[model samples]
Target: MGKARETILEIDLRALEHNYRYLRSKLGPETKFLGVVKAFAYGSDSKRIALKLQDLGIDYLAVAYVKEGVALRNAGVTKPILVLHPQAVNFDQLIEHCLEPSIYSPRILRAFLKTAKKHRQKDYPVHIKFNTGLNRLGFWENDVSHITEEISGGTELRIHSVFSHLAASEDLNEVDFTQKQIETFDKITTQIDHKLGYRPFRHLLNTSGIINYPEAQYDMVRSGIGLYGFGNEAQIDAELKPVATLKTIISQIHRIEPGESVGYNRAFFSNGYRTTATLPLGHADGIGRQYGHGKTYVEVNGQKAFIIGNVCMDMLMIDITGIDCKEGDEVIVFGKNPNADRFAATADTISYELLTGISQRVNRLFIGD
Candidate 1:
């Protein structure tokens, strides 16, 4: 990819393919791979990313909502899509679009069964979520009997898979807790198999789990951050390549004398002669106000320039003293050199928030099909 002529995000399909293959190398030959393309494919172009993943032969794709899945279908994605947090009201639309839902509660399960029966559908694939420890969403282990009873009552729904979330798979200090969660899930699956008289595919690993606990890769593994080139560990990060690179051009340059202030509320006061360059992106573009006042820095002419003053809604200023930069010069917001993870660390944040926080207003330029 070339340097930015304007504020834009460059996505490399080749990097995405590399990350996918790297993750696959850790899985068993028969284990399935599910690529998560939710949150606009982590703030990149979802339609484009989904298409690439489909062409790459991903076994399944996951989105966080029904509308996201529908968008994929509209974009000609034919692979199975799992809506991780579907609402009961959209059950009809979900069925109409052929998107699977992760049923986590009794009310939602009943609502979906009604919709399936209304459509006169048989064996409609549905994923059951058990709350092993995440506590965010899922049915309790004791709900197995309830779920089995509901399934036995009708044939409108079929448990295609059972899955749970990992609360702290990335934190090695939480190994004991994660193990307990895994053990609990195993027991839940056993009960589910006994009660239902059959076994549905089981999965309980996220991106970190895939790296830290490969032994628990049950039947399939879902990867979101890993697919986007972030493994959540320093050693693993070295093996993956970031897929998105945010870049902008220097909109203008300013010279400030000692005691002069810059930006709103005079947030940055110069103690000596200083030079700064402004860029055409700010809080609204996902570089939030939290990054201002020397909290973070951007690369200007291959040199680190710390952000000064308050980050505006559509503009931000970075001190460029001693740097040989001028108007319209290419500035790397975050990319391979610093990477999103390193850039986000300057503000005490993470790559996921930074990547997904990128606004839609920023133009996206794709490389490598």
Candidate 2:
């Protein structure tokens, strides 16, 4: 919350707590909450975010890979961690760290069972993933019977929950498709419950799914972007505070005359006298090349300074002709005012890509415990 004297990504833990509490307020008392801390907690520090969520009494945590879960375990995270995409090779390490795996296919299920048995483990919690509509992963509806049959005779693994990914819960235009996916997931769960003669907890909502399709929130809800301060919709965004703010200082200011070019490939030719400010962050720091050429702008001294020319690997220039800013003045790349969603829109991308693309080299400063 202080002025930026150097390039840094400020992580606001209080904002994270606010977002968590806000999302929890939408759920029933019994509904569980799973915080997705994959990709360095959406390009912020995952260990810190996970710890904050843990302190907030989160029911579960999720990561994209086994290594991420192991890292959390190493950092003293004791809450249940679901590895969304556990590989066969790391099944041993996953079990050793007490990380749960989402068994989406027959091959992974079989591999995990073997690994669990080899480790002499019993009743190890594993989630079953159903391919409701997101063709990315998960077993088909017909494969439900196969999953039940395979697990029925084994004690090495236990189906902790059955879950599915919603393809377009954030897009209202895809309501029909999303409803059908929910219906299909319902049928799959019903079949699994019937065949297994018991019920495994079910979950089928992501962040947007929790907001747009609350009816489908079965046993738990998973939130990734929302916890990081984006809600995909303007109204919901207003209720949440962004947890990451990228800030930098003007390294230098330049006065350009007419016909003077700037940056790589002479991307910008000044038509008149203008002033530009260079910041020590660029494509290598996750401000991609597509955001160049005045497509996107950053805030300098509370004024909009459009980016000019191509973004270099470690620096970028912004037009500051009329702005009253100088070297060492704070510049906001994206945060409260513009927010990640609006900033990402200039390049036709989403907040997820921008947030996750931030280079790890950027110094992270935390505010709020």
Candidate 3:
């Protein structure tokens, strides 16, 4: 490349590994771990993270869609993958990639079974999702009998895992609700396991679940946010490292006069004369327009500079007053000292929202082991 791009995301794979090892340490050897790399590894880079995790010997990998799983497979990841929210249309491709689908509804199960039969796949692996609490995806409790009956009658299909989503595992305040979800999932799994006479891999604990409920950590745990360096529990976060760092370069620097208005809609009117810096990244690059008008900032020479106005489509201006910085100067939007979560905190949001919101146009760079 002629010159390094102004906008880039630095992903720390070492932190990713640290998070994985920390989570893995919490669970017993019997309980396997599945690394969730969906949403481009939570807006980092799934291919890189998945490959690293695979090399580190993660028990399994997971993705939200069939295409996400396919991407991992295309990247030479031979480990088993769970498609968390697989679409009906991609069942064939999922099967082709040797990716397992988490079948929740009877309609989807039937469609996938049909596909397996057409492919002449014997002992085709699948995971059953129960709607213990999330209610977003998974088979309802009432459908347990149907699932068991279907499983018992068929020998071509094999149940690989039975799992449920935690409605709010991170919220300690929702302890009772989370317990109820765990209890409900347990009952469903026991009832189905008894009827079908199959001992499938059982998992319910996510990153939060692993932190708060070691007792509930079943045969395997699926962790998403944990791998990306966020666990709702402060103690857990203390042990985890943030993986994605958002950085940009100053395209230009300018001096503004007192009483001058900046950006569209004149959202920011400076009371004092100040110096400003223009960044080549903006709302289109994942910095929400809401962050404009003094809600966000970039680190300039170890100091924070607030956004001056409404964020534009491709750029934003920051009040770099009193800071010694210029064009080509690096601005740390979120990383290390001034982390992304803290940066997002100014906008009343979380790191997850900001990371997943990172647009594809921004370049991604991976660093360290």
Clash count list over all predictions? 0, 0, 0
Candidate 3 C-alpha lDDT tens digits along 137-166:
888988988987776676668988899989
Q: Sort the predicted structures by lDDT, highest score first.
A: 1, 2, 3
RMSD of 2: 0.8
Q: Evaluate model 3: give its lDDT.
A: 0.87
TM-scores for all candidates: the values are 0.99, 0.99, 0.96
lDDT (0-100) at residue 118 of candidate 3?
88
- Candidate 1 lDDT, tens digit per residue, 159-264? 9999999999999999999999999999999999988888899998999999999999999999999999999999999999999999999999999999999999
Off by over 4 Å in 1: none
Pairs that clash in candidate 3: none
- Candidate 2 displacement at residue 90 in angstroms: 0.5
The weakest ten consecutive residues by lDDT in model 3 span 1-10
Computed on alpha carbons, the lDDT of every model, listed in order, comes to 0.94, 0.94, 0.87
